[model samples]
Target: MDKLLSNIKIEVPPGIYLKDPESSSLGKKIVENSIILLENIGFEDFNFKKLGQLIGSNESSIYRYFESKHKLLIYLTSWYWSWIEYQLVLETYSINDTKDKLIKAIEIVSRTTKQDSKYSHINEVLLNQIVINENSKSYLTKDVDIENKDGSFMPYKRVVQRISEIISAYNTSYKYPLTLASSVIESALHQQFVKIHFKSITNCNDEITPTEFFIDLTLKTLTDGK
Candidate 1:
């Protein structure tokens, strides 16, 4: 353990404080700091000068690491999706019961969204843009494939597909409707977060946790087909 720790060096940005100096993890550290700044200030207000100052690094050095702010945003967005995919796969899909599978998938997704603040914020922004962009592109292009190439496979759709697959796995013999399951799953996933954070959906005064509501509502509706 001591040898491994000794070998593991982390790069300290030019002016950043480091209790223990290491260089190996410097890139990752910068990315993490970048995410914090992005979340607090957002992409519109974020500036490389400010970020470099905060990290104790020169603007030029930061640029060397990340070509541009837009590039960083894209990388961060992709990273969030990769983490989400890992989490989705970890949920046990073959639980031998259709309802349980649906509940588990919902639980994982809600837990992931609630726990990861940066990811949750990114997901909200990207999902809204993705929906609008894809819809607009589809109208513009006569070809569905061309429309997809413009803006397709948003995270929302990925989550819905994973949830649908889990539900379908358990009901393989019965062959539940994929479209119906997808609709309920998407609604259940988005409604919980959207209602509380985006806007109060109608007159519901309850501040329910996303995971509990999603798991309960999704499982019940998907299994019973009601």
Candidate 2:
């Protein structure tokens, strides 16, 4: 997640940088420029100073908008999820049934995943943090009051819940609950990518894209051996 977001430039100069309560145009520019930089230099070599310099802004000015690198990382992760939600909403316009919705949803996610090169680093970082780092798992899954006092869940949990809702709409005859299927989907989505990251020796030259395989397999499973 951090790596994917590392492409975004949050702080810019007084004249060129984004101000607090960022205007949409300025914010979009910051994200676009940041992605260009990240693609060239990678995240480890990128930072506010480098970004600020590239965008004709001062480091201090950048800090004013994002505060710290940590805040910037959180913002990026949330932005990815928000974007997914928005795309799903848009795709729903063409989907009238659960089966179609599930298939469309998978296709949309797969397309977005492939096109967003920024997410490569983000996916790599998230997999490492969630599966390898004990402390990060706790933070990622820490309970929060999303709807009611008694109904609390973590950030990832909510994401999973949304995924489950989409899954549930598929073939009602299938006995397995959408929640369980969602967990399977999430595990497959995140962990498999990380595994591929290593198995390909970090070159990312795999032939069969996860999107294709996942979409086909998930549809079959959800459709009761279809």
Candidate 3:
């Protein structure tokens, strides 16, 4: 179990980068600054030359780590999901109650992540902002099919699968465990996106995060027929 493992390593698909960003100090710096820049200017306005200036590295150096801006975005978002997966396990590991596990899973996925101080190399908090605002851009492209086949989305799918298993513990016969899991995860993102950008339409209370609402709705769907 990932929860029980120590010093866990997350694998970004080999296709996502020309070189592993964690391997060298410079490569790691590129990743650390990439998050800050992507969250600051947004991906549409982000480029290697700009990143090169930010990190005092040449554009060619950035290219050596990532083939294109698109791949970099994918790498960042994939890393975000992997981080989320770890948190999900850490948060829910002690809960034996199925409903409690389900609720915690939803919150961990939906709520903004706190920056993990031990991981100074990556800013979990800022990365969550990028995931909220720009994650779709990583996959909504012409190469999505190619990337998808190459396991670009496996980290994300693994997260969803973990939560889906928690749901199954409550209702093993539930035909739509994965479906329900995917819906809950996406709903968290969309609700927060809408609440932030188009608040007039969302009636959510400011005191309560979307995670609470999602958990209530998910519980209704899972327990309504019982």
Tens digits of lDDT, candidate 2, 113-147:
53444433234234223222221222343332322
Displacement of the residue 197 alpha carbon in candidate 2, Å: 5.0
Candidate number achieving the greatest lDDT relative to the actual structure = 3
TM-score of each: 0.57, 0.58, 0.94
Which is the better candidate, 2 or 3, if ranked by TM-score?
A: 3
lDDT at position 207, candidate 3: 80
Candidate 1 lDDT over residue span 1-226, tens digit each: 4454344222222222222212335555566566667666666687779887777877876666666665455445434444555556655634767666666666665553434343322344443322222222222335435523544235435656676677666565435546745655445446554555667462222556656765665556555643
- The superposed Cα distance between candidate 1 and the true structure at residue 142, in angstroms, equals 17
Overall local distance difference test of candidate 3? 0.87
Alpha-carbon deviation at 63 in model 3, angstroms: 0.4
Worst 10 residues of 3 by lDDT: 1-10
Reference-based TM-score, model 3:
0.94
Q: Which candidate is the best by TM-score?
A: 3
User: What C-alpha RMSD separates each model from the true structure?
Assistant: 9.2, 9.1, 2.3
| Rank ordering of all candidates by lDDT, starting from the highest | 3, 1, 2
Question: What's the lDDT for all of these models?
Answer: 0.51, 0.50, 0.87
Q: In model 3, which runs have C-alpha deviations exceeding 4 angstroms? A: 1-6
